[model samples]
Target: MSRAIEVILRDEIFTELEIEYPDDRNTNLLEQGMDSAGFLKLVVLMESKFNIAVPDEDLLFENFSTAGLIIHYLTEKTMS
Candidate 1:
């Protein structure tokens, strides 16, 4: 799941948002300079590629500021 998230992030959002382990990517993307469009694009790609529905509430910066959050959500979705 982390790998998939990383691919979507790197390909759809930032070319440099590398995530070897989703749990380790605690960086605040917005604080670091990522824009809103990039974040939305990643979310869209993630929803399509992973077939996981992300709630509207999950669109918050706190929910997807890092790869770890993405993986955590995806992992939970895949498991369920």
Candidate 2:
């Protein structure tokens, strides 16, 4: 997987938001503050790093609600 998203995401988004991963739990990110912009940025970053084209439709809450989830999705996508 591309560490680009993880590095940028952690250093940029989480730090800027002053959000520490409180618990080992959280699935719904939109409820927190990761709105459409974050989702769109992530989609772009992933696409660029992986050399894959991710349709805008894939940038849904169900797909990118969390970093781990996003990683999982990308792993699956790149392999198949």
TM, every model: 0.67, 0.60
Tens-digit per-residue lDDT, 1-80, candidate 1: 66776666556545433323233478666655667776777677677767888899778877877766767777787778
User: How many residue pairs clash in each candidate at the backbone level?
Assistant: 0, 0
Candidate 2 matches the true fold with a TM-score of 0.60
* Candidate with the greatest TM-score versus the true structure: 1
Cα deviation at 15, candidate 1, in Å, is 4.3
The parts of candidate 1 lying over 4 Å away from their true place are 1-24
Q: Candidate 1: give the clashing pairs.
A: none
Q: How would you encode candidate 2's per-residue C-alpha lDDT over 1-80 as one tens digit per residue?
A: 44654565556556655444323334566656676776676677667666678876775778777767766777777777
Q: Model 2 — which ten-residue stretch has the worst lDDT?
A: 17-26
For residue 43, give model 2's deviation from the true position in Å.
0.4
